[model samples]
Structures are given as C-alpha cells and as structure tokens.
Target chain A: MSSGYVPGLEGIVASQTAISMVDGENGRLVYQGYVIADLAEQMSFEEVAFLLWEGRLPNRSELDALSLELANHRTLTQAANITLDALPTDTDPMDVLRSVVSVQGVEHRLGKPSVPLAIHATASFPTILARFHRRQSGLDPIQPRADLGHAANYLYMMNGKESSPEVVRALNTYLVLLADHGMNASTFTARVIASTESDLISSLVGAIGALKGPAHGGAPAAVIEQLELIGTADNAERWMRDARKRKVKFMGFGHRVYRVYDPRAKILKEMCRRMNPKFYELATKVEEVALQILHEEHPERPQSTNVEFYSAGVLQAIGLPKGYFTPTFASARVAGWSAHVLEQAAHNRIIRPQSEYIGPEPRKPIPLAERV
Target chain B: MAEFSPGLEGVVAAETAVSEVDGANGRLIYRGGYLIEDLVPVVSFEEAAYLLWHGELPNESQLDALREQMATARTLNKSARGTLMAMDAATEPMDVLRTVVSAQGASKSLTKPSLDEAIALTAVFPTIVGAARRRGQGKAIVEPRADLGHAANLLWMMHGEEPAPEKVHLVDTYLVLLADHGLNASTFAARVVASTGSDLTSCVVGAIAALKGPAHGGATLAARNMLDKIGSAEDAEKWLREAHARHERFSGFGHRVYRTYDPRAKILREMAKTAAPDLHRTAARTEEVALAILHEAHPERPNATNVDFWASVVLTGAGIPKELFTTVFATSRVSGWTAHVLESLADLRIIRPASRWVGPEPGKKPLQLTKR
Candidate 1:
C-alpha cells in the first residue's frame, strides 16, 4: 500500500545501509558497528574513511596504500585549477568547493563509482578549499604535502606553514566526528543522486549543494555569528531572551534526530573547553541560558546543544575564518559522502519517490492571445 | 520502525502544487489546473516556467516582464565566463553545465531561495549550453540577443544565426513538455537540496548533477543513439531481435510510473512526424519492434513507449547534438527545479530519512592496527 505524504520524509526509511547508524534514542553514532566514541579520539580521518568504504579497519599496509592513493590524488585537475582561478575572490568557500569539485571530477567517460575514484574525489576537497582561501588572501597556493596526514596537510595548504600537533589533532577529530552521520540531508542527497546510478562527483557536488543550506552544514558559521552577536557571557541571557521574543532561532540548539544530547557535540564541547577557553567560556554560559529558556518554552521536549554549537568554537580555535566553517565541514564529510555514494551504488536503485499533488484539477488553458 | 521502502517507490515524500504526473490515467497536469496536452499548445517555455513558479499563467504585460527579466539575466557574469572558458572544450556538456552554473551562482554569502533568483537561474542555462557547444566545435561564442524570445535566443546563441520560426516552435514545445515531471529524480534532488533551506543556485546545481545520470536525463541521448545504431526502419526488427536475444533492455520503452503511453510521448510522437521525418520513421519502427519483443518476454506487463523515445527524434530535429540531450533537458527543467525550491520555502524541513542498518550489531570494538 502507498503511504500518505510524509512531510520532510521525517521517519520514512529510504534505504538499507551498512555504512553508519544514528541511534538517536541512545545518543550513539555507529560507523560499521563500532561506536563513534571509540573511534573519534583514536582513529585518523583516513582510517575512518577506509572503514566506511571497506566496512573494516585497515591494517598497516592497507592504510599506507590508501593514504598514498589519497595523497597522489590531492592535486587538482588542470581544468579544476582554471575553474578555481576563475571564481571571484569574495565568493563563499562552500560555493568554491562545490564548483571546483565538479570541475576536478569531470571525466571523459561514465565509469562506475569505485574506491579509487572516491579516494581521488575525497583527496581534492582540502586542496580546493585551501587554494581558494589562499587566492582570496592574495597569497600563492601552497601545494599539498604527501608526507602529511589529511588533517595536517589541510592546515599546511591553508597556511604557508604546518599547524601544531594539538590543532592538527583537533581538526582530525572534527573530521572523524563529522565523517558520516547516517541519512543526513546532505548524505541523503548524495544517495538519492547515486541511487540513479550517477557518477560519484555528481552525487558529491549535489551533496555539497545540500550542505550549503543553513539548516544543514551551513549552521556552524551561523553559530559563530550568533555567538558574536551575543558578544559577552554577561549579555548572553538578555540578548538571547530578546532574540527569542523576536522569534529568532538560537543557532545550533535543536536537532530533529537526537532526543538526547548529540555524542559528537559532547566530544566537540570538551575539545572546545580545552582549546578555546575564551569561546568555550562564553559558549558555555550562552548554552546554559539558551537551554534554560528553551526548556522553559518546551518543557517536555529535549533541548540540548548540537554538534554545530561546539563545532563553531572548535573550528574557531583551529584558526578557521567564519566563512570556512561550512566548507571545512564539507572537507571532512566528503569521506562520508563518498562512502555513502559507494554504498548506494553497490546496491543501486533509482530513488524516485512520489508526491501528493496539491494543484488544481486539470482543465483547458486560455489561448495566449485571448488572455488579458 | 516503518518498513524500509527500497528506492522509496511508493512513499509520498512531498505535497506539491507544482505539477502532477497522474500516471494512472496517463495525464500530466501543470499548476493552475491546465493539463499537459492542453498547456502545450498555449504556452512558451517562459510561460510554462512562469506558471510553475507563480502557479498561474502570465498575461500580456506579465509575460513581457518575464521575458525582459529573463533577457536581462541571460548574460553570464565575469566569474561564470571565466569558469566556462576554464573547462576543456571537449568535456561533457553536463559536467560543464554543472560547474559553470555553480560558478555563476557563487555568492559572498548564503541567501534564501527567491523567485527573482529562480528566473535568473532559468535564463542562464541556454547561455551555458550554447557556450559549451560552441566551445566544443571551436566556434566563437555568440552573444545572446535580448530581443529574441527564450527558445529563439537559445537557437541564435547555439547556431550564430536566426532560427527558423518552426524550429523555435519545435524547441519551445519540447521545453514546455519536459519542463517538469512531478518529483522525478533530478527534481527530487532539487527539492531535497531546497528542503535544507539551501540557495536557489545550489538547488539548481544539484538538480543538474542528478540529471547527468544515464538513468535519468541521459535516456534521451541513449534513445537517440539506439536509433542511430539501428540505422534505418528496415533494420529495426533485426536490431530488436538480436538485442532481446542478448538480454538487452530496450532504451526509452519502459517507465516506472506510466501504465499507458506517456502523454508527453504521445504529443512528441505526433510532432516527430514533421520535425525529423526520417529519424521519426526509424524510431517508430524501432518502438514497434521493441514493444513486441518486450511483450513477448513479459505479457503481464503493460509496456509502452516513454517520453525519451520521441524526445530523441524531436531533439535531433531541433538540431541539438546527442551529447547535449541531458543538458538540454536541464535547460527546460531548471524552471521546475527552481519552482519546487521556492515552493519548499513555505514549509522548509530537512528531508532526512531513516535508514535500516544492515551491518553487524552496533558497539563492536575495533582492533589496534598493529594487532590486526
């Protein structure tokens, strides 16, 4: 039987996936049967990506080979470089990422999505963002270093020098946490595109477009912006209460899936406390006030800070400009997007869902000349 | 806890007033109550686009305003031009379209999707399509004429000359017919992106990426290629027999929604007689043979020719190269894509669906790399 319209497709199960699961009730994120908490601090982004793609942790040799492959594909295609140079300096980095990634993955043929291709697409995200960021800053682009890991190489390419171990570790954890979150709007966009047997780049470019939304990957920067508006910890309650009265949403506060606290946010919150003491201090106060207000209004519903809330502080601590927050999230999530694309392609079907027509009953039309 | 629907086939994911595919009765309905067959004779592509966006057909002054708005937005910005020139002339047209559109739409910050933005996005497609084609042939880019109508201008930019009236009518009709087909993969991709509250350009870009798939917009080209391989009407039966023997599925002969002949296909089938008489003759013969073979294999199935079959012949008549069939489809569907995005804004929600996990049980511990 055909189910009735499910607005936003809130609880509709679309596909059978082995990649990742969002256990909302338990506040757990599982990637390939392993809990996210176990992997977040320990596994590298490359290792998590490998696990997502291969459904198992890679041994030393396999990890090395995958790293080499990713490092080798780090350089942008010639067309991608030209396309990158073509974008205006003031353009949003997310748009730059979307466009450059499209150009970078343009192929002469239509090939089945494979791990090698996924590696090639995943490797280019950082280089695209970093190169564009540098070009905007009036600096020459820094080439990617093969010897460095994904997180370290991204910082090296963005800045002219390497980042400290602490910052690199934070970025790696951010990437690992954001890698795949099971059937998210952007990941669903990727799967829906891939469900049609589209190319991996097409699926990814589509996902990037989806992620640019304020409700999705676009929120991290908005969080920073909201926090900036709040200014200081002492002003937090007053500003938030006023903003709430004006019907302004507190950025990064509510999530659709999590009935409890998001596990990723809990980890990023701790990191923010350690690395960005000032932002952490202000953010903590704001969070407390916001949650108190939210709880006052909704009493029965769970109102906890989401990943984007603490992610703002963490990314800020890592020295990213506010504009790069969403794109940085994209850089990490490309691994997940690509992994999901591979999974969707492995057991492919065209994801053509129905729509309940709310238009008028069909009738004859007026001739163009006869109309007023 | 709902049953997992593979491909979301019968799940009604949206409530849309944009258009409706009443596949049961073989009817297609556009907004404002006009049937597809009824609307085709009265509206130009711009008018069809206006109807989709505003839910009503424009009058004389309104249509003029739309035409003026579209003409003003036809020229690509400097960044878009640079991006267009950046691609290899020989790159796939859809790839070029995807990248160039993203570059064109790249902005300094996120903006909510708007009707004005939709019109601007719809107007630029022909420019990118024409530019890609001209570059592929090493021809100087032809500037779009503000005085010409949308279809006429597209022909002018692509051919560098005034198009015959009949040819423009043919192309315009094709555009009108293919403008929207209720929640199809590409349009669904657009809505999913829009549901995240993404910008209009991101939604359109994502739609274009999904349209690049062979299973979706690429079907027109495949249908045309199949006919070309068949060579003539005489070889139709032989080709069908051999293809069937080899277990090859006929291109453009089957669809997911329609139980009878597609209404759009019926109209295009009749138009194909005069548009490209010779190709139409071969296509007609091929459809007959293909249907016969398909029926022999599955008598229970209600097999019919889909829109792509006749679209190929009509497009060939309109002088679009087979390589660009999908891009041409994008040019038409951008209006519907943008319309869906705009409609989605009234009640925006993230289209995040649930996934049934098929992997091993969660909470598994990972082995250390050296130990593994």
Candidate 2:
C-alpha cells in the first residue's frame, strides 16, 4: 500500500476515465472525442447525454430513440411520488432529489450499471424537481411532454407552458456545458460507488449528496447571492472590496483546476450577455474586480473565474429559483454521474483507500462497573 | 501526479483518531486507543458510538442519557414513514434503508454535520431497518420500545417479541465490532461527501449507497448464501472443489488488509460456535476447504477470513433474514460514517482528486447534426 498521505487526494490519479477531461492548462473540456465548445451551442442536452453515456454523439434516428426513452421515463414510481409529497414543501430541492431518487430506484434489484438505467435516472430528475416546485407553490403538476426536447420539457413541466425557443436553446447550452467534467468530486463519488459494483441509483444518490455541498455543484446559488449583495455594476468594486475585507469569499471565482479561463465559463459569459444583459453588466464588473483582487492576494495561483460565475445569470434567465440551483446542477450532472458509473462497472474494483492512524497506542478499557 | 492506483489500494487519504485497522498485526483499535477486544466485553453499541463521536466512552450517567436520546428518536417522521409505507413490501431492504433515511433527514436548511444529528441518525436506523424487514416478511411493522436498549429494540421491532438475552448479546457484539474501521470505502464516501460541506444526512446517505455494494457490506449475505449452498459439513469439500473448478471466488475467505485472521472475524468465529452450532460446523468445514484451495492457487496470499465470514453465522443465529444483511450492516456503520464526517469538519477541503485522462484529442470539431 502507498503510505504517502495526499490531502484531499489532490494529485492522486484515482481513475483513468475516457468520458471527459479537464485540460486545465489548455483551458479545454473534452467529452468523449469532441470538445465541449463544439457541443455546447450545436447539440441538444439529450445528444450530449448520449455522447457521455455511449462515448460518441448520436445520429438522427438514435437521437430520436434516446429522446423518446428519456421522455417515457419522466413519470415517477409510486414510491417516488409518495416520497416527493412526504418531504416538506419548503425542503431544499436538492434534499428532495436525494430522497426521491433513492425511492425511485428502490424497486429495482441491485443491477449492474447500464445505459437504460442511466437514461431513466437522467429523465426523472426534471420531473422530480418540477413536481416539487409545483407542490411548494400550490400549483397542479404538469406532466412532461414527449414532444419537447429535454431542456424544453424541463421548462414546460415547471411552468405549465413552453418557454421561448431561445430560452430553451440557452438551457440546452448550459446543460451541455455542465454535463460532465473529468473526475470531479461528485463524479468521483459516483465512480467510487460504482467501483463497489453498486447499482446506478445508489451511485447517483451519492453523487447528489456530494454535489449539495457548497463547494462543488452548490456554487451557482452563492454566485447569485453574491451578485444580489453587490446589487449594481456601479457598486461592484466597492461592495466586493468591503465584502473581502470582512472575510467573505468572492463566491464563484476560484476553482481547483482550470489554470486558464474555463471553456464553459467563456461560453456562458456570452450567453449571459445576450440573455440577461442587466445581470451581465453587473456580473462582468464584479468578475473583473474579484479576479483582480484574488490575483493580488495569490499571484502565483491559477485564480480565475469559474463556470459557476456566469451560470447563475443563465439559470436565472431560464427562470429557475435560486435554491433549485444545486439540484438543477444535479439534474445536469446525473448524466455524467451515471455515465461514469457505467464506465466504472465495466471495469470494477472496490475503491477502499487507506487512512493513516493518528491516535494513542492500543490500551485496555475499564469494565463498566469499575468506571467512575 | 502520482501514477494511477486502481481502487487507491495503498493511498492514504486522511489522518484520523477515530479508529484504526492495523492490518499487519490484525488489531482493530477504536477511538481513545482501546482495542476492539477490550471494548467489546465492556460496552454496548451505544457506548461505542458515543466513544466514536465524542472521543471517549460515556460514563454510567452519560450512557443513560444516550439511551433516552436514542429512545426518543426511534420513531420515523411522517415523511419518512409515508415514504416507507409507499414502497412495495417486496422491495429490497437495503434500498428501503437508503431511501427512508434520505427522506427522514430531508429539511429546508443545509446544516453542518453535528454530533447530535449523528446520534439521531444512528437511532433511526433500527426503526427503518425493522420496518423494512417486517414489510419484506409480509408482516406488519412494529413500533420501537423505549425501555429496550438499541440491539434489543431492533430485535423487538423486527420480530415483535421479547429478544433472548443471548441473541441480543450476539447482535450487540456484531454491531460494536463493525461500528468503525478507519477510512473503509463507505466511510471514505461519507468523508468525500462531507468534504463538500454537505449536511450530515447527505454524508450518511452517500455512505449507505456505498455500503449496498456486494464487495462491501453485502458480502455478509453472500457469505451466508454460499454456506446455504454448501448445505452441510459433509458437502463442504465437494462444493468447494467444484466451485474452485468453476473459478467461483470464495465470498468470505479473502481480504486485502488482513494478513492474518480479521480481529472481528476472530471474535465472531468464537461466538458463532455457540450461537449457531450447526451452521458453524458447516462453515468451519467450508472455511478449511476453501482456505486449502485458495492457498494452493495463490500460496503467497495471507491466511484470510474477513469479518463478513463469521458475521453471517452470527446474524443468522440472531434471527435476521439474509435479505436484510446489508441493511443490518448499514444499521451499525452509520455511526462510523457520521463520525468520519464530523472528524472531517475540523479540516474540510473539497476532495476533487486528479484524474488520468484517457481520451481523444480535444481539438476535434463536431460535424453538423444533419451531416452526421
């Protein structure tokens, strides 16, 4: 066993994955053989999901079949439906996703990770969130429409009406950009579960939990919150400087990887400008000031704006609530999570990493009666 | 970057005082540096849990307070119960455990992992496990008894009768033996999730998902089933020889860490002789034959019999059905999982490890959808 301790396993190469790569030095993201930029604006969310799961982009007929399968699996199981209603109306949507997804997958026996399971789980996330959103607002739930594309159906289910084509297009791009990113903490969580030969839902439930943390998929809401605190473009520098001096983190700025500007962030920055100009105006100013301040503090570090920086503006423009941000990230990343699970199951090993003990030497315990 | 280590076999991910698996010497030490053998004879499962979370065993009054706290938290909240009742009675018990626990802990706010929440989470496990067990048996769910201790209450709720003292002792010992092991896969999963600054429920949920894997906690059920297949002591040699010819891996005979007999398995082996003499007879014969065959194939390997091997016999004697084996494992492991999360809270870092990218070059442009 390697006796060296790697804090956070930062430089440890845990797995060899073909699904996605974060080319941090070059500022590129690759899914299968294709660059993320090529897929972002041109492909539908379903196409990107297919590519992640199968290692290649789907053709026209294959894309149709995949879309239909995702559409068909949108309805929740009886257990999942009841579980959804069981959680409090005000419960965090991420918690709802974690609980409902667990119940939804409980009916199946522990089966190997497969594409069908991935598709079914990917399809259900939108339905789970939409239903929970409706219940919280005392509105009747809208059934998922088979005719709509993945992003459109998600929007339709949430609001009982179809969104504009451009809005749907923006969402598709956001989903595509966020679909997968190498072995991220959450994706690593999914793969770790899959390496144990656990089923797809178990892997996904674990991933959801990991993503709900404020560090990973939990960043979009914080980005929005920071922007709200800044309030306007005119106040960007002063407010951010004051907030930093008060020891508040400039949310959505730093990332562990990405030495150069993130590819997804570059694309979302453009989308924000076009779709949410007001947010774009204020956010760009804050991003500039935050980056400059961060650079001054850590000049040697690769401190740059991350994907979550502009994702808040884009998700808000697409009409999602702030609290739904992390769960929405889960909805997108479930594609990556399940794909990683399948890849892991195909070549499985139990991921039982060692730990260094830092405790007292072995000692005897006093008997219960003898204890004071 | 360090070379890719599959399953992170030798990688040391964290430094902790919670517990240690000193595999080379076959010693298992819990918090406060007490060896497993010393603690088992002196404390109940609750006291061990208290020790793991608080770094010391509770005194008499503290133990009494813990019992009362556990007793009060035994009942499932409305949402969790509704979700539990919603599942088909025929569903797998581990799935029920993962789902109901998720629902039970669902809330509007995201809270940090805490010691109090850990106790509550640990207390609720028996209630869910018992409900799932009864539902699987096509019997009515039983409410928990406040007067009974943790292990006794588990048997009482599942069987709806007074548990024999001998049986309760076996179950309690099993729980204590398995409660904590340093950085095992499930505990690693919990810490990974907790590193994201996720809530205790999220961390525990991730741990349960990992434990459902056949290579982890599910091995107990597999071990028992393999014994059932052997049928009797007389059949052990023939079954072992044939299974070896077929290249079937012996389920409970090998472990990666323990070079000698597993310390917990050693204790359980002794208890199994008295707890289920008939099964122990068959298991003893089967272990002998299996070890002989394994050694013949790989002589360099250690003489290995993991904790699962004997846990099966002991759990069987305690009257738990085979299907609930993983859930029972989770019932004990939630303590260790939450403990790792809380320990991790003092030094939280997002555990996004580096990945070895094995993919196509990133510059490849996507062909248009119609052209493709």
Query: After superposition, which runs of candidate 2 have C-alpha atoms over 4 Å from their true positions?
Result: none
- Candidate 2's TM-score reads 0.99
What are the per-model C-alpha RMSD values against the true structure? 1.2, 0.9
The sequence of per-residue lDDT tens digits that candidate 1 reaches over residues B102-147 is 9999998889989999999989999999998999999999998999
For chain B alone, what TM-score does every candidate structure achieve against the true structure?
A: 0.99, 0.99
Considering the true interface contacts (CA pairs under 8 Å between chains A and B), give the fraction that model 2 also has. 0.86
Candidate 1: list runs displaced more than 4 Å: none
Write down the TM-score of every candidate: 0.98, 0.99
lDDT of 1 at B144: 89
- For residues A11-102, could you state the per-residue lDDT of candidate 1 as single tens digits? 89998989999999989999999999999999999999999999999999999999999999999988889888888889889999999999
Q: What would the per-residue lDDT of candidate 2 be over residues A1-372, giving only the tens digit for each residue?
A: 656887898878899888999989889899997888888998999989998998888889999999999989999998899889988898999999999999888754778778998999999999999999999999999999988989999999999999999999998898899999988889999988887777899999999999999888888998998899899989998898888889999888878889999999999999999999999999999989998999988899989999999999999999999988788888889999998898888878889999998888988888766677
